[model samples]
Target: MSLSFDVFWSFRSPYSYLVTKRLVRLVEEWDVTAVIRPVRPLAVRTPDHFVRMDPLWRPYLFLDTKRTADYLGLPFARPRPDPIIQDPQTNVIAAEQPYIQNLTHLGIAACRMGRGLAYIDHVGSMLWDGTVVGWDQGDHLARAAAAAGLDHDRLQAMVDDDRDGCEAELQANEAALRAAGHWGVPTFVFEGEPFFGQDHLDVLLWRLRRHGTARRSSGEAVDG
Candidate 1:
């Protein structure tokens, strides 16, 4: 038997970025498989949520994320273009529309191709690392996808066109995530247990190891 975990990820999430780096290492070290399930960020699916964010939330996020970045020694900066790509004057988010659609769809596509982890790391880094000013541009996303060894052109074309096949798959992922009892990014689920946030990864790992040992000792096949 092989151990497997499902990761509920969101590209618009800075916390997801932090989790990705650690998750990559965990899967390799533990010899386990990670099932990446990408979903649209809360801002897109529920704009009202964004509007309700407290003013202090932004500063709090910066402080917390900085501490996490320092601890992990990973590059950290506020996203340049920000996930909410909109015109200040008109309050229009044309530039952002494609990203919400594409990021969500790309996860499903990568899963289909068995390259879900790669896709998440590459694209998620670009969105969270704050290296680029505007990630909404097709070129930026394409380049990131290329870095992940995926066919940039094909992925871009699919995302740009909102191909029904991909969109439908993403919707399913979102539904599954919601049914899993979490609406946040970087949620890890094992045996129906939900752990939300990067801060909980260690706890999750402990659970996995404990469960693995118990199963093995009970004469059950050990998962990797």
Candidate 2:
């Protein structure tokens, strides 16, 4: 049996985007399963999250994310409209947020179709790679879905067909994240051990190896 781990991720997190590529690589190379568990971003989970942050947090986040993206050779840019809508002056989260809600549901739908990691990686690149201005407009998500071998219309239809079910799954994922002892994105939980942050990916890999996770043998086909 393949070892399995849960990847707790949020669409609004730049660090989540930063770690996805390597997570994809890890699945391809290891004898393990990555269960992508999409959760509402902190802004949604805790309406007062940003409001309570230190004044310097936002500035440092921008500076650090850009440099980290550059270091990783990944294209970087602020999401054009931002995923979570909030008042810039007051950090008050908007009551109506369509972007993240749609993305979260779509993520759950893709996971149900067994392409969660691929879906996030392709779609995330579109949103954060500075490639498109209005990523939510037109057929952008559809094209990204195609890249991940998913039918875009079908994916959306799944979410539309069972919005409540998807929301329930998301809530369960959030509960699982907390149960795993962390509430952060890009957290890789192996055997219930929570490894938070992209910077700790190497440590996670080391731990995986120590627990006997092995490289895929040549000629063994890897699948999502």
TM-score of each prediction = 0.83, 0.96
Tens digit of lDDT per residue, candidate 1, span 82-197? 66665544334453576567667776776666778888888888877768777776588778878777887776566667678777777787787888898888899888888999
Residue 171 displacement (Å), model 2: 0.4
Which candidate's TM-score is highest?
2
**Candidate 1 lDDT score relative to the true structure:** 0.75
| lDDT winner | 2
**Each prediction's Cα lDDT score?**
0.75, 0.90
Residue pairs that clash (backbone atoms under 3 angstroms), model 1:
81-133
Worst 10 residues of 1 by lDDT: 215-224
Candidate 2 local lDDT, 99-159, one digit each (tens): 9999999999999998898899999998899988988889999999999989999999999
